[model samples]
Target: MKPIITTERLIIRELQPDDAAGIFRLDSNPAVHEYLGKSPITTIEEAQNAISFIRKQYETNGIGRWAMVLKDTNEFIGWTGLKLINTEEVNGHRNFYDLGYRLVQEHWRKGYGFEAAKACLDYAFSVMKLEKVYANAEKGNTGSNTILQKLQPVHTESFWDEGVETIWFEFQNNKIGS
Candidate 1:
């Protein structure tokens, strides 16, 4: 599949049926799901359904989280991109472009997440021409929060919901990394 965005180590492409196993490997890890307040998925069918939902967003909105594959090995490690978000459906977020990323455990701490995120945000601002992007992380998830903080995202909101507290961050195209 042709990639929408490419970096030195990764290629970001639209989700596909073939990415089911990758998605399963990513979301099925309990450690990965801990900060998100969800449990690991036990079946590949669930991963397929999740991919279908993401693919639909591309059809309806023309943008969605994309598959992040390693260029050297062609491994579908995970996904990272801008997702069109609505406040009603996704609590703590207003209608805005949301920056998100998730990866399988073996790929963690190697800077792939940060590398993919920078490329995705660049695409969102330059190619997609978005004005701003929003993001959130659990207060204790230092890794993700650090990624957002390093982008110099302005603090948006800190809200409590469903017994968990999360902090929202925003990155304006003109002010990113300023």
Candidate 2:
């Protein structure tokens, strides 16, 4: 498939049904699910279901996570892209697009996460013409939170997410000048 975004060492492309195994390999590991408070998928079928759900997001929301493939090895590393989130804030706030990424443990700390994320943010701002994007990390996920820290600060707030405390971070599109 043609790539949606390409980084120095990675290819970001649409997720496909054949990606089920690679996704299962990434999401099924307990280490990967640590920060997100999610359970690892036990089988490929479950991963397929998750992929189907993400594919629907592209059709309905005009955006969704894409597969991240390593350029050197042609390996399916994980996923990264924008997602639409609904907020229950009492002030009439509703939906917004946010950035997110996940990669297998073996690829962690190799700079794949940030490379793909920075590319995604660039695309969202310049090509997609989005004004703002938001991201959040569980309060204790220092690794993920550190990534969010690299961007300019908007505000940090604590909230209960599915009963767990989390920190939300927002970023404005810089477009060309930013």
Candidate 3:
């Protein structure tokens, strides 16, 4: 598949049905979901369902998280991209574009998250012509919080999400990477 965004070591593309195994490997790791506030999946079927839902977002909303693959070995690392948040309000905002990324447990802390996220942020602002993009990380997830900070969002605030303190960041098209 053609990559929607390519980094030095990663290729970001639409999630495919064949990625179910990779998705399962990612979402089934308890350590990965520690700050996501979501339960780990127990079955490949659940991962397939998750892929279907993300694919539907691409059709219904024009964008969704894309699979992150290694450029050298063509391995599915995880997912990274934008999600159009129109169905629910997060931090009192709705109908916005959000940047997100998830990686396999072994891939954590190797800078892939930041690499993929920065590429997606650039895409959202340039190709998509989006005015702004929002991202949130659980307060305790230091790695994620740090990456969001590096993107240099225009504004930030702390809010409660299901009893967990989360930091919300807003990156304006003009202020990104500044």
Candidate 4:
């Protein structure tokens, strides 16, 4: 497997076909899907398709979300990384790159999201040469919003998909470590 970034406790890597089962497990958990605005995945095929799309994003965008795995246990936890949000209103913004992540319920409150996200922000600003990275979380998703606040302050509240209220955060490149 082509690993993208390896942290002390996690290995951020490209999604693979074999990862469908793990992705299914992660996406099927209602608790995990609670804040994501979508229902739990009902089939492994859906996860497989998602993996394929993620692979395509890596090829087409050069920077896409990565599958995060625990290093010591080698278990698939979830994903974290950057993505391009090309919607017109969002596209009009100066910083179109967005940092995102999703972790399994078992991994919640374990600092893995923060650890992996910090690394992703470093890569976005330092390696990818992005000026800023943005992120959003549902209004009541305090855990995700808290993690984002550590990286960047909330710039505004926006509606995602014209419905859910999301708090958007922005991290400028100058703040990233070289």
TM-score of each: 0.93, 0.91, 0.98, 0.90
Best by lDDT: 3
TM-score of model 3 (CA atoms): 0.98
What is the C-alpha RMSD, rounded to one decimal, of candidate 1? 1.7
How well is each residue in 1-178 modelled by candidate 4, as lDDT tens digits?
Answer: 8778888899999888898988998999999988876699999999999999888887887767789999998899998988876644552464288888999899999999989998998887678887777877887899998787776543656566457777777678766322
* CA error at residue 104 for candidate 1, angstroms: 0.3
Judging by lDDT, tell me the better candidate of 1 and 2: 1
* Residue pairs with backbone overlap in model 3: none
- 2 or 3: which has the higher lDDT? 3
State in Å the error of residue 172, model 1: 0.5
lDDT, each prediction: 0.86, 0.84, 0.94, 0.82
lDDT of 3 by residue, 1-178 (tens): 9999999999999999999999999999999999987699999999999999999999999999999999999999999999999999999999999999999989989999999988998898889999999999999999999889988989999999999999999998867662
Clashes of each: 0, 0, 0, 0
Q: What TM-score, to 2 decimals, does candidate 2 have?
A: 0.91
